[model samples]
Target: MLDTTKYEETTISTTPACQEDPTGVNYRGNLSRTIQDQTCQAWTSQDPYQHTKTPANYPNAGLDNNYCRNLDMRFTAWCFTTNPGTRWDFCAVGYLDPKCQATPACQEDPTGVNYRGNLSQTINNHTCQAWTSQDPHEHANTPADFPNAGLDENYCRNPNIENTAWCYTTDPETRWEYCAVGYLDPRCQATPACQEDPTGVHYRGLLSRTIGDHTCQAWTSQDPNQHTKTPANYPNAGLDNNYCRNPDGVNTAWCYTTNPETRWEYCAVGYLDPRCQGSVV
Candidate 1:
């Protein structure tokens, strides 16, 4: 019975709270506050920045570009308030910085009428020797046409100098000179000298003579039994007896006795017997 009278009903539309986007305008205010707080924290954690003092802040801060227009001008001369260092003069005249200063006007030299610069008499004379294009060796008439003849060749070749001569030397023997082949000891002989003694009693065949003193005698295997005796000239006849024996089959003989002094004394060729100490038997 109720459904028979059902009529068409119109409903009013409204925004739904659950359907709103969180990333849209609803959360914008919260995002902005978070970013601001982070920025403040970062700035607070940074190191302190230093600022330079300017003339405008300190009235008594010595003369500089800020104080005058022409720092170097004679009429507007000023002194530096701060000392930069020993090398720099920081005076000011009619200006806070040096750039505003005017060029120094030329002045007549009291000592000489020809001079018309600000330089003193001593400075002017010292720097009078200006560089010239003409050959420096023209006055000396040296072998090579070297410009600036008196100057050292090394000085001319320095990178700082322009239009200088090729002063480098090519000789190997010279300390600073360059050469294709460096100098070495030319007296060094490739072949060894005779090792035999002048008396020919201790002949170490083809040995180097320069190794030891040449005064010692060269011995030969021809005398294999001759030994050294302590009694000066007596053959192996004394208590301190030493004998020369050849064990290597070489021409050289070696000492075989227990006596240290006569142990290895060299004997002549014919002295092979134990009794032939001084005599070549």
Candidate 2:
């Protein structure tokens, strides 16, 4: 739970001028650049939101503890809102005459450093940023040309990642890529997207935790519309049955459902989720 005292700045101070560092140095009005003890790495975005490369003469020192000292959610736009078209930059500088008044007199980053453009995650009760190196087009690690290996039963293991005819393929890295949320690769365990194999089974996605005696798609988390899980990943969801898809979605192949009767209406055909006893009931 959020401490109301801290949110209101009653226990803390908002005036950057009144802020202080660990060494007892008062930071009054010298907020232009990073000062070892005074300036914080995480803060409200600059008045004129800047992204891509760090800009010189950038205004706004940012909030101290990544806290929303002042939130004007009434407006359609917000400081925390990100725009991926511009690499998840914050709201335009003059959009809402934006201002993120953060609470707490102390700085979030003592050293005052962070990767300029990266996604943040909660780590050890602190917001930790990470590489946003996103490659949505799946344009890497593809072979230009190769002779097919003889057909075999142990081939095409990762058809989801690499959709090539693996039975005749010849290589261990056929469909190698980063792991997904519920299907973390045992070989690539160090990635950020990797999830623990909770069910002592692989390839179940979130279904790794078996419901009765089965895996992913056997039992879903929620209506697919609100989540990102899709039939491509959870093929066991049944032929054209989108119930196992991500939540909040409407007609997308991702898991979705307005109600029980129409659950499989929009699902892709020829795809039978493993849970339907090989087909729908």
Q: Identify the leading candidate in terms of lDDT.
A: 2
TM-score of each: 0.11, 0.16
Q: Roughly what TM-score does model 1 have, to 2 decimal places?
A: 0.11
- Number of backbone collisions per candidate, in order? 23, 32
The residue-level lDDT of candidate 2 at 248 comes to 30
1-281 per-residue lDDT for model 2 (tens digits): 76687677743443222121211112122222111111222344542334221223223322343322212111111122232221111121111111212321113321112111111111001121111211222322222222122111222222222321112112222222221111221111221111222111222232121111111232234543234354455455442331223333242223234444433332211122211212222
- In model 2, where do residues sit more than 4 Å from their true spots? 1-147, 157-161, 164-184, 192-211, 215-281
What 10-residue stretch in candidate 2 is worst by lDDT? 115-124
Worst 10 residues of 1 by lDDT: 178-187
Please write out the lDDT profile of model 1 over residues 1-281, one tens digit for every residue. 56533342211112111112101212111111110011111111112222233344433433233221111111121122222221111122111112221221111211122211121101001111111222222222222443434332222121222221122322222112111110101011121111222223333222111101111222222133353322344322222312232333344343332233332433222222111222322
